[model samples]
Target: MTHSLEEHGTEREGPLSLQEIDEIIGTENPPLRNLRITYAYHQLAVALARLLDDRNATWCGFGTWASRTAGLFIRGELKPRPVGLPPVPPWVSRHLMTWAAPHVGSNVARGNLLVFQELGPLFHTMVTAYTEEDDAERALERVLQPLRPGLVTEGGQDLLIAAARSYHRAMPLPHSAARSQVILLANLQVALHEQIRLQEAIAASLAPPLRAPFTPAPLNVLATRFWGRLATSHLMDVYMPAVDFTTTRTLIPLRLGRDVGGAHGATTFCEHLTDLIDLELKALLYDFDRSPNSVLGSAAADWSLLAERMNYLTDFFRLWQQDPCLMQAPFTPRQAEDLRAGKMPSGPPL
Candidate 1:
């Protein structure tokens, strides 16, 4: 049997008052109660996507609702009921009541997805701070306490503890050799610990990953939740193109006749620094997809390594940004032009 927002009896449009939104979702029908609650979550996600785009969106309030509701959902105690939301942005409110559309269960999932996106900025800041400090417990509390409230539902109290465990499982202190010097890299490691917590909360709300018919792709769903746009634009606009000019046309055609040790030298360098960057981005996408349900898997370990690599790469990229000339890598002199290419060397010379 198919269920929908209208069949659940919600008013499509009029005013964006939370009260009106409240009414569309509030009801005594036991059979439709869950559907109503999920619909409310969907509308809220749509509203939030609009607000986040505004430079003046009220994040603190959004954080409050997200934290409390996230806590509720995590604890499995979320009631299909109205929420005491902070006042909606006047412009947003003005149009919300006039808003009407077909809705689906995935909207609720998208709402949860938006919560992930909305929380990202705060997450970045918190992770930065968490990684710098040596004391784990103190750092965890310093960050966690601010978000904690008396109303955090079931199992919410244990989230930080679980994340901390995952952090240690993946990243033991005293730092790995690869992670020792770079603070940015270290910060990413610390940040993942917190990300684990957020992922856990979301996953608890969306288990087994159900997909509604004609729903958006998972990456698109996540991207839109955060940026209200597609992933391609988000990545391309924000990230520099992955290219390694040092190795550009580094490969040469030799009919056993081309001058030996000439041009790119006898050494055949088939790889470019860009390849590493692309690999990292791919790894990141993989991690993002897995993060939803990765409380216990090898995700912690994978993130730990990726964070270290990202740190080093970030520094490398930033250095190039400061002085573009810094990226002109000198070609290595190879002794013999062997036809068979060997294993691509790992780790940048940086």
Candidate 2:
């Protein structure tokens, strides 16, 4: 039977008053602190998205976020719910949300997915300062901290924001593309880890590989709980088409391509970076659909890696969807050819 948060009960619209949002999803959930934090970020995201000129795009992000929240509180599906979120620009938020819509599920992974979207992929960035073990998550805390609101901010060691007095300036905020790129890439990294965890759980549960670790038994029918949260960052190709690492003469530490050669330069090299996404997804599907060699063929695994891979792929595409930079690719192949042979940005003809 199909279930939906919107259909489950009589839903209420806000002015929910802070207490209401808090009470419905309150500490009754595990990872309670994080869920409260996610809801808080969603509130901030809603307010911020309203400020953008492109309201539809902004609304997209907010809607996905709210739906995810409702899903968590209602708790029907199997995926984990998100706890807290970092600030994400409305446009990027829209793209990521759209890309991920198909992958959304209830329960555990959903929550984890949202947090992964809000926070970028530096899953292992050491959280300390000055080599003091006692510092505890300080370095990580700083990175996770939202950007300061101002013209110019420092990221240390020659990294400067160059200030934006207005949004119309040549460069867009890193918060949009940068955040999406980091988050998507980070999710990829963690998927492998989560896969391992699932593997462990599967091994312990039964020797037969064909069975799904989770089935009809619903969780949060189990929350009374809440929980949580990288960066190769391929999304730069999607967001920043004109200004690139090679063009700007900067060494960006991203792992978007395979072997950094051939046609797969960055995700944005093609329209929508669809090729890169398709490739990754195909590989994932192969794993999910194909079975590993076994001496005793004890029923191949069911739930396919496709489920989780699609989840990450959805997030990746969402970031690409909302990028204003992606709205215009600087030059087409013919234009590049003409320019290489000496031509203007307009070139000879279409």
Clash pairs (backbone) in predicted model 1: 14-97, 15-97, 16-97, 267-334
Per-residue lDDT over 1-350 for candidate 1, one digit per residue giving the tens place of the 0 to 100 score: 02222332222311133343334234333223332332333333223222221111122212322232332232333222121112434344223212211121233334444443323333333444455667866665655654533222331334333333333332332333221212222223233333443443323222322345676688546533322111111110111112332344132221111111212221221122122332323343354333221121211211113342233323222122112211122111230011001212223221
RMSD of each candidate? 24.4, 21.3
Error of 1 at 188 (Å): 18
CA lDDT, candidate 1, residue 267: 27
lDDT of 2 by residue, 1-350 (tens): 02221221112211213343334333444333333333333333233232322211222222233333333333322222121123544455345433333232222333443443322222111112212334433533443344343322122211111111111121132434333333233333334333343443222221221234564445422111110010012111111222232233222221221112111233332232233433333454345322211111211122223343334333333333343322121234344333233333243211
**TM-scores across all candidates?**
0.22, 0.26
Q: Please report how far candidate 1 places residue 72 from its true position, in Å.
A: 28
Task: Evaluate residue 160 in candidate 1 and report its C-alpha lDDT on the 0 to 100 scale.
Answer: 33
What lDDT does each candidate get?
Answer: 0.28, 0.28
